[model samples]
Target: MGWFLGLGIAGLVVLALSLVFDGVLEGVGGGLDGLLSLPVIAGFVSALGFTGALATGAAGAGAVLATLAGIAAGTLAGWATWSFSRALLRDGAPAPRGEDLTGTSGAVVTAIPAGGYGEVLLHLAGQPVKYAAKAAAPVARGAEVWVESVLSPTSVTVRPVER
Candidate 1:
């Protein structure tokens, strides 16, 4: 009973440290996170080992068997948790809407030759977004332009601003 409580406390401390730091100590590598994270493995294994030992009336020799069982159980649990969390938190970015660009003013990043593609930089959602641009006539670099239409998701048509 005493061993169980001690191990449980130690496991809780390890989990707390892992959460509080949140990989700031990942200089050595990120083995402290993901499915094989040390804190998670330790917490699961220690809790299970304590429970198993108590349930089976495990004594000195039986302690080793209980520990081995705990390790196997912990590994599976950790893997399952990691996989589930990753699926839920998968990388995804919102699509930039086309209507958001039309009529917006931007500056030419590259000189636009007559009927040719150049680049323009516009501020969208407080971030700079660069898109391919075109003009009916030549537009010099750093010249202000107005977005005429969205040519594609990543490109746009623009015209030089008069004076």
Candidate 2:
């Protein structure tokens, strides 16, 4: 009982350390990728120690039975931790790019003189952003426009919307 309790406390300490040194132990398993990450190891140890103590103290189980129960619990905990971490680290859709802004609609924020630059308000990745804009024909401030082409990182060629 005493040893089990001590192990449980030690496991908790390791878990705290894992939080502070996240990703540091990711390479410890060499060829295992992230399967043996700190969080997974910590989950296994904590579950094993705590479950062993519970089994022995509450159920009056012998050492062998307690240890087996602890192993089963620990395996489940470790697998759960691994799965969750992998899901979080998985990549999602590629980020929106400036080229993606082409053909998108916007409004003139400042009047654009023919063949000169002004400002337009457009949505990039669902967020409103201002860009330096140029057009073949003058566009008045607050006029609706369509982005014709992205000229640079911070500028675009636009055309006034007829309607």
Query: Considering every candidate listed, which one attains the maximal lDDT?
Result: 2
**Model 2 ranges with Cα > 4 A deviation:** 1-20, 107-111, 140-144
Candidate 1: 10-residue stretch with minimal lDDT: 23-32
Q: Any residue pairs clashing in model 2, and if so which?
A: none
Clashes by residue pair, model 1:
none
The per-residue C-alpha lDDT of model 1 at residue 121 equals 99
Cα lDDT tens digits, model 2, 1-163, are 6777776787788889988887887777898877788788888888888899999999999899988988898899989999998888786878989999999999999999998999999999999999999999999999999999999999999998886
lDDT string for model 1 (16-133, tens) is 7777664454445556445555544555755665554564465553666766665666566657656665677685767668668999999999999999999999877668989988
Give Cα-based local distance difference scores for all models.
0.73, 0.90
The alpha-carbon lDDT assigned to residue 103 of candidate 2 equals: 95
User: How many clashes in each structure?
Assistant: 0, 0
lDDT of 1 at 8: 55
